[model samples]
Target: MKTLKCPLCGNELTSIFRMTKTGSLKNKYGCLICGWETFELRKNENLAWKDAKEFISKFPPIMRSHQGDNLKLDFEDDVLTLIGKDTSRGKLYLQNCDGDVEIATPEDVEQWPWELEQKGGSNDI
Candidate 1:
């Protein structure tokens, strides 16, 4: 059998299989270096290879963080922002005067509880 190589990083690819809750088998192809993944249910090796090849050709490569990487945080006044790595999205946190906290997105910040906003706390970090 020919070894599969990751399209984005040229690293050797690995195959993983799992049993679904419905008792069906699921097959996945993954790259440890680039964190690329594709799923298919073909039982035949040839079909699985075809699906993997198609997915690799069509899927975009995404940056991934290595193990043990630390994420940076930004604080502005009363708001805090968490910087995400790889394909993760950043998150914003809002804190109130009574020490209560709530998570919100940038677009939803304005719609957050008026009292929280009045506390002069905003996080775009």
Candidate 2:
């Protein structure tokens, strides 16, 4: 994978597939530190992206992992917000998920974005 550095803050950039209001998925590159991002609009051909609020509601409001960790799910500005029950764990912001955010889908939800996973994690949720 290629490394993406933020030109403004020298921080690593994160890439995610964001659903546009026009019903398209765009590959977005953004910096958690400086809030710098690139506006990239692309056409989604295969996956039928759903609304953030609607998709999140499919799962239970609270989810528990096999390791006994718990997270509360919420939606904001088309992003999936995962708030850890433990205060020290920090929040995880997700742009996409597999199926529903439930116990059965723990494996998929654990697979966070590559860049964020590398640098510990981001609390910019």
Q: Write the per-residue lDDT of candidate 1 for residues 31-110, one digit (tens) a residue.
A: 88888766666655566666766665453322221122122223333433223223345344444445555554443433
Decoy 1 TM-score against native: 0.38
Worst 10 residues of 2 by lDDT: 45-54
RMSD of 2: 16.3
Model 1 clash pairs are 79-122, 81-125
Q: lDDT of model 1 at residue 14? A: 79
For model 1, the superposed segments whose C-alpha errors exceed 4 Å read 57-125
Model 2 Cα lDDT, one tens digit per residue, 20-78: 78876676556788886555433531121222212222433222111222333332222
